[model samples]
Target: MSLFSAAVAGFGTGLSLIAAIGAQNAFVLRQGIQRRHVGAVVAVCVLSDAALILAGTAGMGALVETAPWALTAARIGGAVFLAAYAALALRRSLRPAALTVDASAAGPGGRSAGRGPLAAAVLTCLALTWLNPHVYLDTVVLLGSVAATHGDGGRWRFAAGAVAASVVWFVAIGYGARVLRGLFARPVAWRVLDAVVAAVMLALAASLVAGIPG
Candidate 1:
């Protein structure tokens, strides 16, 4: 196939995998709506995915196969991280003042926090990306294996396309969420959203624990 075709294939495949409503997307959506360090959050997510896609394209998938323990470690760490985060989200819902702050917070370009808040946001984003085993499965393994079908030159192009998709999708989710500003202007809405985030995070942790089963 031509480079263009390979790229299109990669874009579509990546979209299909990431478009699903998972922990990463949920966190992105929440950050987007909260308008707290959105640029940083989006950049972290996009860059992380790009790195993973490139690693997969570069044949890191084989290394992953030889190091199955890596994923197991990620799974355990991710679950703990996600569960703790879920509890935080749930706790936030109980604090009316927290949602009030979210409702009147800055725009997509606003600072969600400073010093401590920034550090927490960045740390959470990193944990959400690196701790998640599914990310390794889908990007490093599945996407990498799929890229091989396009041959050498085409595979790189495919990886590029996938990376592009990550950039586009994250930008859209992070910035596009601003359109719902009116809806999220209410503190109740923020609370509801937090509850949903908690549920999603817990669900993701549960799925990780279940895995493929014996």
Candidate 2:
């Protein structure tokens, strides 16, 4: 296939994989709604995906395809990360909404106050992108498998297209969702949002642990 064809194929594949309601997407949406380091969150998500897509294109994905041990380790690490993230989300959900603060007071004295929003966002993005076996299966194994059909030169083109799609989708989701922050200003809305995030995270973690195929 030509480079154009490869790019189109890669774009479609990337969209299909990322359109799902995964933990990473959930975290991005939640952070956007909470108006907490949204730019940082979006950047991490897009950049991480781009990096992975690049690796997959570079034929690094074949290494993962050859290693069962790598897959197993990824599964274990992903499960732990998801479980911990779920617990944190649940705690935040259960906390009284009155404790939430405006973005201005979102510092140390703020409700969800922490010194590591950027770090946390990066770590979370990494866990969701790298540790998760599904990410590898979809972006690396599956995408790489398909790209291989287009010949060696086409693979890089495909990967580039996929990375581009990730950048567009993640940036839109992370920043665009911020427009709804006002609607969630009420404490009840905050609680409801957190509750939904908690449920999504927990359910995703359980599904991952259950070895559900992506």
Candidate 3:
């Protein structure tokens, strides 16, 4: 296949894998709506995806496949982290009035009074990306296998396309979420969003647990 075709295929596959409302996307959306450290959040996501894709292209997928224990460890860790995040979201949902007041007091970027510190947010982003076993399955195994089918030269093109898709998707969702700022201006909206986030996090946690071997 031609390099362009390989790239397009990779881009499409990458977008399809990540376009879902997973933990990472939910966190990005929340940060975006809060008008918080969106750049940092998006940067972490994009760079992480790029690194994973490159690793996959370099055939790290085989190593991951051989290590069943690694995935199990990641599954448990991811589930715990996600469950804790869900509890936090649920707690925040219970206090929409406080969120509203704090959000109103929030200053632009850097360190907003209402938003978590940049370091904390970045840490959470890293956890959501790295700890999830599914990330390994999807980016490393699946994408890598597909890229390999395109032959050595085309595989690099495919990987590049996948990385491009990550960049585009994160940037769009991270910034585009601000369009909902007007709606989230209401306390009820904040409550609803937190509630939804909690649900997504919990569901993802459950799914990860279910994937573990008996």
Candidate 3 Cα lDDT to native: 0.90
Determine the C-alpha RMSD for candidate 3 after optimal superposition of all C-alphas.
Answer: 2.8
Q: lDDT tens digits, residues 85-189, model 3? A: 999999988975445524447433433445667899899999999999999999999999999999989999999999999999999999999888888878889
Q: Which candidate number maximizes TM-score?
A: 3
Per-residue lDDT for 133-153 in model 1, tens only? Answer: 999899999999999999989
Q: lDDT per prediction? A: 0.85, 0.75, 0.90
Candidate 2 lDDT tens digits, 90-112: 67666663335355545334434
CA error at residue 195 for candidate 2, angstroms: 2.1
Question: By TM-score, is 1 or 2 better?
Answer: 1
Better of 2 and 3 by TM-score: 3
Best by lDDT: 3
Model 1 stretches with alpha carbons more than 4 Å out: 101-116, 212-214
Model 2 residue 34 lDDT score: 58
**Model 1: ten consecutive residues of lowest lDDT:** 107-116
Identify the runs in model 3 with alpha carbons over 4 angstroms from their true place.
Answer: 101-112
Poorest stretch of ten by lDDT in candidate 3? 101-110
| TM-score for candidate 3 | 0.94
| Local distance difference test, candidate 2 | 0.75
